[model samples]
Target: MSFAPFSDAPGTLDAAATAARLPWSALAEEIAALLWDSTVSVPARSVLPLAQGGSLFVMPATDRSVAMTKLITFTPGNAGTGRPSIQGDVVVFDIATGERRLVLDGPTVTARRTAAVSLLAARHLAPVPQGPLLIVGAGVQGRAHAEAFVVGLGVQEVWIASRSAASAEALAAHVHALGAQARVVADADAALPHCPLVATCTPAQAVVLSATPRSDAFIAAVGAFTPTMVELAPALCQHVALHGTIVVDTGDAGHEAGDLLQAGLDVATMPMLRNVVCGPWTHGTRAGKGPVLFKSCGWAGWDLAAARLAMRRAAAEPPMPAAAVRVPA
Candidate 1:
């Protein structure tokens, strides 16, 4: 039997649409299952650094029925050039036939799916009714987190903090424009007490969020993917040792990320998302904690999952000719 390769156009999904299509809890559960399943394969990503000061990553993943390759680019100056900071394309392939199936734009997908993952961690581990969230860094992650917390987690108030006061104010205004209660804080440290939920989104080489959070607080650090970037302080790692559940995205990435490396933290001993979902909750571990800390290394599995979700949604709509193609021999 000859298989026809269907060329699905790269669909552009806005943040709101993406959120509506892929809920945080559902995506997180899907990711958790994929990670736990022994049949699925997610290899270490391949990175290509741009000479102009950005990087691209190619991530490939596959199971029996589904396979996907996602190309993600991080261009910091793209925002100044009237483009998004992070953008890319995801190509989904038929695992059995090895035929191209679908293509999806990844900018909005990354933002929405990343926020969903963070929200899921908060929902399962963070303290309930945790309000007055503090978001450090006024970048894409900051804005996305605000929306997810408000729409998905029912957060009442959000405080925006950045090294640049103007950026923080602007982010606050943007979130408030969406009808959420949001404001800018002059001092990130001062806002810690009021924030039961804190998200660090900056790409800093040193710890930006150094203030100790309350025992009942929940923290999500989305920055610090590289060995040089650090968002949470050594003290925060100590706090995790003493009182909170320290959940890293993966053991290998955590070993390289500066936040863990600087603090001499070992993810080999830390509880991973896989452990939380599959294992028994024992005392003095991720299973027991009032304040929980989740550090995301931005895995490829997330991009693959988000791409699959987006493709499924795009497939459900009235078929567009742009999404179809004639196969050639």
Candidate 2:
């Protein structure tokens, strides 16, 4: 069981391998344990604005055992250039030896971590994980959420929709291949009401989900990280009564998530996921309270947990095959 350090390119590590390494249940539990550990430290991530309306993010964290840093770049304009708007690399290193561990794909790690964190938060707020799940945006995060919520959490089924129908169909096919029941919807509105659990994964300036949501609905919005981007409508944000409070992955998300910021929300008062995971936060509901919201602005804590697991899983694998190149393993 040599879960040690190695050097690899950004995408040398496969997504399935990463997902397998960080199983949904174990990953969520480890994240909870990481939150429980008082010795671990994670500061606010570093952000630098790029000249082209994009931004660069430097996220670092450590459990005093494994240290990791993720260099992420978000360029909104890259949508038309055949390149994704979100791209980066996660670099993990050994704390004892100061040796570099492995480099996992940023988007791959981000997609899995974001969805898993959503699952973590959902465990506290949402009803039993056996209901329909509505996933907006048929991109990486959308597909990943289908895996997390349906395959990971045992959701009964998944409904996928996107701005592009072709993309939606593509994701639907992928989900079906996973042996999960899924279909492409015309838009999010049609599917939003039926599903009690929803994961919004998009970078839209306008709100994607509108109209009154179910009072008990649990939404996890992973996109719209910038102050200029908004996912949930301000109307929805304003109506969320105290009983069904908006949840966040980090303490400072209200400052970063455009949805909450635009809604004029006092995000400081919003419940943080760490508190919910650490302490006893009863999520029982009231009759008329608005829908529950869980918004994430990306966090270094999640990256560190995912990276450490990936490194250890890599080292534990059997010797690489002749047809396979040496990855982080």
The lDDT leader among the candidates is: 2
lDDT of 2 at 171: 86
Which one wins on TM-score?
Answer: 2
Candidate 1 regions exceeding 4 Å error are: 1-25, 77-83, 282-290, 320-329
Cα lDDT tens digits, model 2, 1-329, are: 56434353333544554556677776776777778777777888889999978889999999878998999998878764668777888888889987775667787888888888898888877754566888888877888888887766778678887888888888888878877888778878877778888889986657898756677788888888878888888887777644467888887686788888888888888778887887655465323355778888888988888876777777887743433333445
Quality of model 2 by C-alpha lDDT: 0.78
lDDT of 1: 0.73
lDDT of each: 0.73, 0.78
Clashes of 1: 0
Cα TM-score of candidate 2: 0.89
